[model samples]
Target: MDFSSKLLENAVYEMSQLPGIGKRTALRLVLHLLKQPEERTNLLSEALTDLRAKVNFCKSCHNISDTEICEICSNHKRDKSLVCVVEDIRDVMAIESTSQYNGLYHVLGGKISPMEGIGPQDLSIVSLVNRVKEGEVKELIFALSSTMEGDTTNFYIYKQLEGLDVTTSTIARGIAVGDELEYADEVTLGRSILNRIPFENSIKAS
Candidate 1:
């Protein structure tokens, strides 16, 4: 972890701050950048700056978008009445890659995790409930990860839609109990979606 220069040290520290990256890797990256042309580094910096400044969340589904609403939410071909509730945009992308789901999505941004200090209020649960309450939505599919936090979040949302006339379900447990949807292969994830079980059944089994 020794650095010859303060500038290199600071660069390594910043790069190492990224998840899963260590000091040695960060130094290698810094050296790689140093070897590259200045234009390459400038281009990388400019791209990151532009992404931060220009990206916005969709007003309807809260997914990443350039406009007020995401393309999925605005698409007329998607079934508006069937909603797949997920942890984040990554889950949305995973589900969409299947090409089996023709429904809309509700990205929760994150799940309820007490250890991490994440609560229902911290996510987009209210927007999801409102989407169901506004009354075109007939089905609510819980497509969150199978972890404890994911289950807790799903249960919370299921309870929120209790008095409403919507049918609720969760993707089948084809993936392992603690696996994330984003990590699952398309075939398994797609089959799970197609064979989703009732939310009540899922809750009862747990």
Candidate 2:
């Protein structure tokens, strides 16, 4: 390939590596980007380059933030005594879209998957425990998936907070089994949160 062709090929390859994008889609995107004004293309490239430079995970909740703490964490209107535990930031976005929850969130960063070599220690469970140990938390709602890893993580967290004063609960069955919390619709997720059940009682009643 010539110089210009080589640049196109590189762009296509990089775009194809993104999730849910294949070669054809990547080629289409590259062609679209190429059609934009030179300044617009430059801005796009600079934004992509600055993504890592500008964004960082909030230390308190582990959500993506531009500053030390995310806006949610800094908001005084949010309920500080209640926390919703989720697997990742995408799940946070899903729940936020619902506009029904008023509590803070704790992002686990990942679920506990022994088969994939991810354990409780690999997540932000310890940080969550520390947050609870502060004695300000009154409730912990587990919004993890209903998958094996999700269940394992939920149980692990329950065990960790066994002697705490706070109540532990999990989202209701509004979401289908084996589905990710991030993929659940806003209405379904909101309903699940509103109808959450105590984790301990849920297991015993099962």
* Among all candidates shown, the one with the greatest lDDT: 2
Compute the lDDT of residue 122 as modeled in candidate 1. Answer: 96
lDDT of 2 by residue, 1-206 (tens): 23368889999999999999999899899889989888887988899889967879999999999989999999999999999999999999999998879999999999999789998878999999999999989999999997888988999999999888999988767877678999999988998898887899768854
Which 10-residue window in model 1 sums to the lowest lDDT? 169-178
Q: Estimate each model's TM-score.
A: 0.83, 0.80
Q: Residue 179's C-alpha lDDT in candidate 2?
A: 89
Candidates in order have lDDT scores of 0.90, 0.91
TM-score, structure 2 vs. true: 0.80
Cα deviation at 5, candidate 2, in Å, is 1.7
